[model samples]
Target: MRQNLSVEEALEAILEGARPIAELEPLPLAQAYGRTLGAELSARVSHPAADDTAVDGYACREADTRGASPENPVRLRVVGLAPAGQPFSQEVGPGQAVQVFTGAPIPLGADAVVRVEDTRREGEFVWLLRPASPADIRRRGEDLVEGQTYLHKGDLLTPARVGLAAAMGHPVLPVVRRPRVGLLTTGDEVVEPGEPLPYGGVYNANSYTVAGLVEEAGGEPVFLGKAPDSPEELRTHLAQTQGLDLLVTTGGVSMGERDVVRKLLEAEGQIHFWRVRIQPGGPLLWATWNGLPLLGLPGNPVSAMVSFLLFGRPLLFRLLGRSDPPYQQLRAVAETRFEANPARRAYRRGILRWAGGYRVASTGSQSSVVLRSMAVGNALVVVEAGKPVRAGEEVEVIPLPGGKTAG
Candidate 1:
C-alpha cells in the first residue's frame, strides 16, 4: 500500500476509482431543487404562443392613426374588447379598433397598439390623439423557442433552473438518485450523546460531523452506530454496509495497538493507501472491502472533519455526477504570524475577510482536539512544511462550505 502521499496524490487516487450512480428517478419540479439532472431537457412549447399586447391599449392599424393629434384627432369605432387569454376573432379594418388588455393577443389585421391613456372612448367610438407603434407587442416565441434544449445532463437544478423547466412545460424532472453512505465510528472511549458520560469518555462527535458533511455533498448518510475497538465488533458493523454506495469510518486507522480497523483492512480489504503527508489528519486511509469503497479518517474530532472536507466531499460529488471542484482555494494576505510544522503540511483554521483585499488570521490554537477552532473559523490557511509565514505574507486559503467572508 502507498504511504505518506501528498494531498493532491491522495485525492487523485480516491477519485480515480469513483463511479457516478446510475439509478434515476423522476421528481416533481418543486422537489427537484439541488438535485442533479439525469437527462437533457428541451422546451415543449414556445412562450407567448401568439403576438400579444404588452400594455392596456387599443389595437388598430397604423395608417388609421397617421397625422392624429390633440387638435386633429382620428375617430374609430371600438368593435370589441380582448382580455388576457382571449383573442379577438374578427379582423380590425382601417376605420375600426379593438380594446386590448395586457397579454391579450393582438386582433387580426391590426399592426400597432396605442396606450389606453393616449385615447378617449365614448359610446363605442375611440379618438386617437397620437400615432401608435408596433414596439408595444411581444412577438411569439420571443422568450423561449419550442424544442430548444435549455438544460443538459449533470446540471444542478437550482431555483431559477427549476422555474425555467416549469416554464418549458415540464411538471417533473429526471434526477440522479442520492448515494447512500454508511457512517461508523470506533473507540471504547466514545459514547452516544445524551447518555451518562463516564470519566475519561467522550461523546461521538465525529458521526454527526461526518454525517452532516455527507448530507451537504448530496449523499444520504446511514448511521451504522459506534463500535468498540474489537475486531469482532468492527467486522460485524462493517457487514451492515451491504447495499450502501460508500463506507466511512473514524478512529482505529493509526498504528496504535488498538487500531483494529487498519488491521482488518490489511487482512481482508484492499488497501490503496495509508497515511497522507498532512498535519492533524496524517492517518487518513483509503481501501475497499467486498467491492465497496471505504475511507478511514483519523480519530481526532478536528482531524476527522478536515479529512472529510478535503477527501470525502469530493468523492460524494463524483458519485452525484457533479463536476464541482473539491474545494475552493484563494490567495490572501496573512494578518498575523503563523507557525510552521517541519515534517508535514499544516492546515490552520482562520477567519477570512475582504478589506481592500483578502485577509486571513489564525483562530487561536491549532490543536487537533480543539473542535471550537472550526466553529469560529471560516477558512483554512495552508502552510508548506518547514516554512514559517510572517504577517503581511500572501498565503493560500480554502474557504469552508457555507462560509461567507466579511467585507
Candidate 2:
C-alpha cells in the first residue's frame, strides 16, 4: 500500500497507468444511442448532392431577372416543373424558366431562384417582379461534404450525432463495448432493502447508488450482492466476478477490524493506494485483483457516492476512450462563510443561484454521513486545503448532473 496522497496526486496515480479498453462492437444506428464511437466516421455522401432550391420558386438565369421590376416585369416561358426528388429534364435558357419547389434540384443553366411570391404565373408564361441572386441556391456539400470526417472517435452517440450518422448513410456504427463492472457492497450489518432489518442493521443503499452511477458512467453493472464480514465469504463474492472489466465495492475499506476489502486485495493481488487527501472520501482505496482494476469506497452513503463521482466515473470514461466528458469548473459567490480542513480539500453541497454572478448557499451541515444535503444540492462548492472562504467571496464550484453554475 502507498502513503496517503492529495486528491490530485491520488487521481494522477490512479490514471497514470490506465489504458482504454480495446473492445469494439458493431451496432445498428437505432441501438447505438449512448454508445461511444470506436473510430472516426467519414461522411459517405455529400448532403444535398446537387444544387437545390431553398423555397418554392422559379429557377431561371440571374441575368433574365435583371432590370425586372413590378412596373415592367420580364416575361419568361415556363419550360417544365421540378418538385423535390423530380428534376426537370430540360435546362433553363434565356426567356425560359422552370417551376421549382423547396429541396428540388436546381434546373441546369439556372443561376438563381426567384421566389414564387416574386413572380406572376399564367399558363406557360411567368413574369419576374424582382431581380434574383445566385445566393438563393443551396449548393452541394453545403451541410456536409463527402469524404470529410463528421464524427470522431470517443464521441457519445447523442440524438444529433445519430441523425448525422443517418444522413451520412451509415446504417451501422462501430462503438466501444460498455465496460462490465462488478459491484459488491461489503458489510455484515448491511441488509438488502425490503428484507427484514435486524437491530443495528442498515439497508444496503450503497449498492443501488453505485449501480446507478456505474450505468450513467457507461458501464454494465454486474451486481454481486453484499459481501459478509468473513474473509472466506468475501473471497466467495470476489470469485464470482472473474471476467468483469473492473470491480467496485462500497464499505470494508476503512481502517477498522472489519475492513476486509483492503486486506483481501493486498493479500490476493496488489493495493496501489489506500487513502486520498480529501474530506468525506479520505478512506478511498484503489487496487488490482487478478488483472482487473478494483476501487473500494468508504461505507458511508455520501462518501461512497462522492468518491465514485470523483474517481470511478473518470475511470469508466477512460475505459471508454473519452479524453473529456463535459465536467467543468466555474466560479461562484458564497452566500455563507465556510471553514476548510487544514490538510484536505472539501466538497460542500450547495444550491447555486444566478444573480449577476452565481451565488451558492450550503444545503446544510457538510458532514460525510449526511446524504440529504447531497440530494438538494445541484453544485459542489469546492474549497482548497487550508483556505477559509468568507461570505460573498468568489469560490470554485463543480456543477452536478442538474446545474445552474455552468454555461
Candidate 3:
C-alpha cells in the first residue's frame, strides 16, 4: 500500500461518483429533527397577508401629518389600539391614528407610522413630531410574497429553516426519513463497557462513539453487538441483517493480521483503499453492497472517528438527499504558534475558536489512540499534506461534526 493519497484522490475512491436518495420511509416532521431530506419541500403560503407594523407605533396617513414638526407638532386622537393576533377597529383618517403594537396588522388607509417616543400623549390625543408619508409604511407582502418558495427541494431541515417553514404556516413538512445505520465492531481484544476487562482487552469505545456520531449526523444507528475475529461468524452476522442503508465496521479495517471485515465482504462489493491524506485517518475503505454503503474503518478509536467525520458524515447527508448539510469549514485566524511535519495533512483535535481576532487550538496529543483529546476538542485544525504550516497561516478547519449544516 502506498503511504498516503491526496485528499481528492482519497475522496474519489470513497464516493460512488453520483448521489442518489437512499431507501427510507416518510416520517412526520415532529420525529424528523435530525433526519436527512428525501425530497424537495415547497412553501405553503406567503409570509404576511397585509402591511404589518414591525414596531410598536401609531399608524396614520403621512399626508395627514404634513407640517408636523418637533416645535409645533400635529395632534391626532388615538381612536383604537391594535395588538398582535387581533384586527384594528378603525382606519386612520385626517388628524386621527390607530395605536399599534409590534406584529399588528396595519389598519386600512394608513400610510406611515410615528413612534411613541416622537409623540406626546394627552388623554386620547397623541402629537406627531414630523411629516410622515405613506411610503414610510411597509408595503403589502413586503416580507414575502404569496406562494413564494422560501426553501427549495432537497434542503436540510435545520431548526431555523424549520422555523421558517412554520412561519410560513406549514404545520407538517415532507422530509426524508433517517436511514438506519448498522454498526459492527470486530476485535478479539475489545471488551464491552462497564465490564471487568481481562488482560490485553480494552473497553469497546468505537461502537458507542460511532453510534452517537451516526445519530448526530441524522442517521438511525442499529447496534449489531460485537463480532469476533472469525470471518465466517462476521459474514453470517452481517448477511442476516437486512434493510440497512449503511453498514459500518471498525477495528478490523487496517492491514493488521486480525483484520477480517475486508475479506468477508470482498465478493459483495469491490473494495477500494483511500489513503485520505489526513493523519489519524489515513487508511480508509469504502464500497457499496446490495444498495447499501459499506464503510470499513480503522481500528484505532481516533482513526475511526476522523474517517467517520470526513467521509461517513457527508455520505449520510448525500444519501438522505440533503444537497448541503450543515458542515461549514471556517478559517479561524491563527492565535497560537504550532508546527506540523511534512507528511499527511493532520486533523488536530482541540478547542478551536476565535478570540481577539485570532485562531487558538490546544490539543493534548496527536496520537491515533487518544480519546481524551477528542472529548475536549470542538474543531479540527487542518495542516496541509507534505508541508509545515507556521503560526498565522490560514488553514481550512472543518467544524466539529454536530448541527445540520453542510461542509
Best by lDDT: 1
Better of 1 and 2 by lDDT: 1
Ten contiguous residues minimizing lDDT sum, candidate 1 = 318-327
Q: Mind giving the per-residue lDDT tens digits that candidate 3 earns over 1-407?
A: 33356766766555656365555565555665655555455556655667777777789888778889999999888889998878696667787899888778889878788877778888999889877545445666676666777776567677777777677776766666677799988888889988999999989999988999898877889999888998877877788559887889887766666678766556555666634567877767776656667887887998898889888887777666776853677877554544564777777775675565436465767788998877877777777766555667766677687522211
Q: Worst lDDT window (10 residues) for model 2?
A: 398-407
1 or 3, greater by lDDT: 1
Model 3 ranges off by over 4 Å: 1-5, 22-32, 89-91, 132-136, 267-269, 274-277, 288-291, 332-343, 403-407
How do all the candidates rank in terms of TM-score, highest first? 2, 1, 3
The C-alpha stretches of model 2 lying farther than 4 A from their native spots are 402-407
TM-score per prediction, in order, is 0.88, 0.94, 0.87
Tens digit of per-residue lDDT, candidate 2, span 183-270 = 9998989998899999999999888878988887788999998889989999998889888988999999988888998888878979
Candidate that would win on TM-score: 2
lDDT of candidate 1 over 30-63, digit per residue (tens): 8999888889999999988889999998999999
**Who is ahead in TM-score, 2 or 3?**
2
